[model samples]
Target: MKRKYTAAAAVTVVATLSLAACSGGSSDQPSATADNKPVTLTMSTWNLANSPEFKTLADGFHAAHPNVTIELKDYDAAQYATLLTADLAAGTAPDILTMKNVTDMVTFASGGQLQDVSDVKLQSGIKGAASYKLDGKQYAIPYRIDGNVIYYNKDLFKAAGVPDPDGSWTWDDYTAAAEKLKTGLKTAGSAALPAYLHGWNALVQNFATAQVPASALKGDFGYMKPYYEQALKMQDGGLQLPFATVTANKTTYQAEFGKQQAAMEIMGTWYVATLLQQQAQGAADKFAWGMAPVPQRTSKTAGTSNTPITYGDPTGFAINVKTDQAKTAAAKQFLAYAESQEAALTLAKIGITPALTDDAVVKVYFGQSGIPSDDLTKFAWAKQKIDPQNPPSPKTATLNTVLSAMHSAIMTGSESIDKAISDAEAQYKNQVG
Candidate 1:
């Protein structure tokens, strides 16, 4: 997701660029400065107090390389880009910069603030690594990826006598299942919602792009119509919560699915961590649950025999251009370690989906306590194709802004799908063209 930069932050960046013209580019520091001596490197991260991924990676890397200390500099997740932009302008940004999405990487790269990390040999399993490349030069490498999947309450399905979802389900199959679940659940005297659709625009826009092609995001968004129609149909049928009600109540998907109020939810793999933590803390009820491949756009793409398409953004790390040669070397080492097999295991054990995953990583992930180990769950984890939610483009930010507004209008019944999409296209041409 993109965050708006404050005027002050923009001003700071412009001022820095002007000053940098007088001061010249970063000084060339030779690798001769690097040695086996102890060194401290700071890396930017978000929500360190609550999210432990950064610290876990840092500690694990430090444990293996005793001479290096990786210090984490935390910032508010919602305001991360704005704050990081300010820091970059002041020349006080962390030695290692954590890019939240492709847009942020583009911004940093275009500003000439990020070091070219093309030399870092990332694992082949990291599918989203190419998303960080611009002009044939790599800037960042992903450590973890959060792909979308259909998370279902197995116990709830059994209670309602509804069949559990498999890799073969298409959007039509999904709708039929939801309709059946709604009827069966009511007859069984259960109050659970058949499905829960989160309020985020990604819920609709990202799915549309993945099922079709991301290039649609750069053109007219006509590809999103059918998806919107299905979502609205479900909402109106009471198979899922209404967009307006969810927005007004500020409902969370965690509570909806965790409390058994929702039988199925389409969410990112990152929720695996939250659910496990909540169950352990007694915040969520313990029950049998598992993930399935998200419904496919067509029957041809809908099965274990075929690779189901889904959308997600990768979180990666980049190095600041101004860091000393010694720290730069150390920072690169940390990046390599972060995507290593050992690090993948550490992330998997904590319910986070590592980018560098293979059969071994899959074994570690399912072997973790409280994680479902059923065949369907394993299938969901092992196979699928992920498309970047945000494709690289200078005008991507404007396109997303237009799509988000279009999503809200259609989902809330404020405007017809055709009308909303039409308006968005006009806005896109006006601002992005």
Candidate 2:
């Protein structure tokens, strides 16, 4: 979901890299296999190298195919695509890669950079398997699904005298809870924040996204206005950290919450891995952490009705089109086993949901003894459809930057919200044009 190429210059760079991707050959010829020959396949992903899931994928793949080796090269999500583009241009691209979302997969597919996975019969009835399909053709395999969830500190909430959130909470409840939590922070004589909002969209757009179908390129910026102004109120009320301070310190939601400096953070389910890893390292066990759904929109909006809706997509892996015959065949075998029901169970054990969203598997994942009994991972599996209408936009990355900058300007007192919005629209047109 992190689109790093949101700046105009970055967009130009992405376009250039895409051209190079287009230069690669599109060989639909079936890859030949050599089961007896030793084969190595590399998959570039943004998951941390220390994550147990990567080990599971590699171990599972290697155990099944004794002659094949799966090497996982990990990167920070922010730098993943930029660094990967370099590797692709240098002819050192990994045999397989995990795109941020369908957007990246589609971009690579359109450029002829990804292998056509049509021959591979994917698991039907899986939540996000078709996310990488374009024009009825498949390009990548959907491996996992991630969406927004509110992670709160149980200790902080108890200390603040605020009640724990329930499944059926709304935006009104969220604001009230935030205010009470702020008071509690002041009462505790702690300068720590009550709520932490990071990333461009998470801070301002999630509310709108939950209420309606919206995207940076084609979305109505006005719907986001209420939250933008609320951000100002939160900053003034000391409920949220100022944008200036956040930018200066380069603080992250994980660090803020893990350090016990923030009471709650609304973020994607992918954080389950970060939190789980930290707990294994005993980094965040001091204060109990729990998950809840994001506040639902109480009212309906354009093309959507109010419910516990949140933003998310099925993110997964794609293979390089230029993979050699033997390597391609090996990669396909690895992908098939890696995204199967067994692999989904493996991911669930660690608090991540695979694209193959099976309720029984998800229930077992949450029922693990170590994790909190009331974890938010299960809420992500609740019966609700993902935002299917908001498809990938070619200029979304660039326009995302524009809106993010606008939010910053208002929060920093550098510009009025209305003026900022006007300016952002102008910039979006200029940059995207």
Candidate 3:
């Protein structure tokens, strides 16, 4: 999800820097003043892969600050962490870096690699900023929030004589709908992305459950057991599809949903835009779709789990401790600009719900595009359900690896649910410890 800055944007930034350097007479002095030198900053980010939206934002930055130069670098998601670590270790990290979550920010802040933005106005521009803060120090700014919602094909529902999914849909209603849709699907039944084991999907289901407030898990070490049980039930139900009939070949959930192979899929806001694009291309003419809050265990309290809550992993901008003071100031200015309304709007156009709270900007970008304007706002509400105490972390990788193995055993009828839970608990405790 890396994007590249355009050539024109690069040239504009360099020219701005050159003029600032010439006027200032030296790079040693602070670059911020009513008059004098310009500042040069470097920003590293993921999701810049030749995207026009990024270019527009970069160009806007140059226009706003005639003396500042901002250089943008894109990194592949798989290589970003490794490259960032190398940069930090070599004392050559970029002035600003993007962190994946509060967990990552905490780890880096603890390691003394990030600059504290506690005093910056940047906090006001970011949405869900509180979630990224640990103990009182703000280490990152969230640019967008994403959460899982049930995306169903309207055409398929109608054809299968299933009721439309709405805010009141219950888990039983959902399963029944799936059973109805299953009768007509090319495959034997519905499919859940295998990637679900990695906290995102499981956490979503956990929040939507009737059992307990997801927030109870925050800081409570033992709450994950119920979370695991809920996930196990969903998996057990989904596995009834024949191995050959269920589709899991695609690497991404969006891809599988886009092909209309799955009657319903659970995904974040990004998929809504992807579906819009497919519709525009006539690839989805036969399908009609809408987003509904994820189903709950009962219809009476369907909205009780925390309406409008979303699960978002924000990537933050941090400064390398070893970077020079001048570079640090420049980087801060660049970070500020990136979080501005103009930049956030550009991101929203491409389906990323901006971390900023400028509703007008959000409406402007999403209004003409025919996207559900309320969906983003609703997701903001949904984010409340995210168990801040048990928010997904790197440990989730190991937890999922074990869950996958246990799930395989369950699918083969080699283990009972109780045994699977016990085994998973043992494995997680061993790995986490």
Best by TM-score: 1
Order the numbered candidates by TM-score, best leading: 1, 2, 3
Order candidates by lDDT, high to low.
1, 2, 3
TM-score (all chains, Cα) for each model:
0.91, 0.80, 0.73
C-alpha RMSD by candidate, in order? 7.6, 8.1, 6.7
lDDT by residue (261-370, candidate 3, tens digit) is 56676565556666777777866544556677765554544653444343445544667677687666666665666666666766766766566646666566556464
Tell me model 3's lDDT, rounded to 2 decimals.
0.54
Q: Number of clashing residue pairs in every model? A: 0, 1, 22
How do the residues 1-433 of candidate 1 rate in per-residue lDDT, one tens digit apiece?
A: 3221222211111000111121221122222125668887888877665666787787766665556667677777768888899999999988999998789998999889999999988777777887798889999989988888999999889988998997899888998999999999998999998999989998888888888764755667889898998898899999999999899999988899999999999988888888998999999999999999998889888888888899888888999999998888888887887788778888887777888778999999998889999878887876778888887767778887888899899998889999999999999898866
Q: Give the per-residue lDDT digits (tens) of candidate 2, residues 40-123.
A: 777775544344566666665555555666666666666667777777777888888877756677667777788888877787
Q: Model 3 off-target regions past 4 Å? A: 1-36, 50-56, 101-103, 122-126, 183-211, 214-251, 278-286, 297-306, 340-342, 368-415, 427-433
Residue 176's lDDT within candidate 2 is 75
Q: Which residue ranges in model 1 land beyond 4 Å of their true spot?
A: 1-34
Give per-residue lDDT, candidate 3, residue 408.
Answer: 51
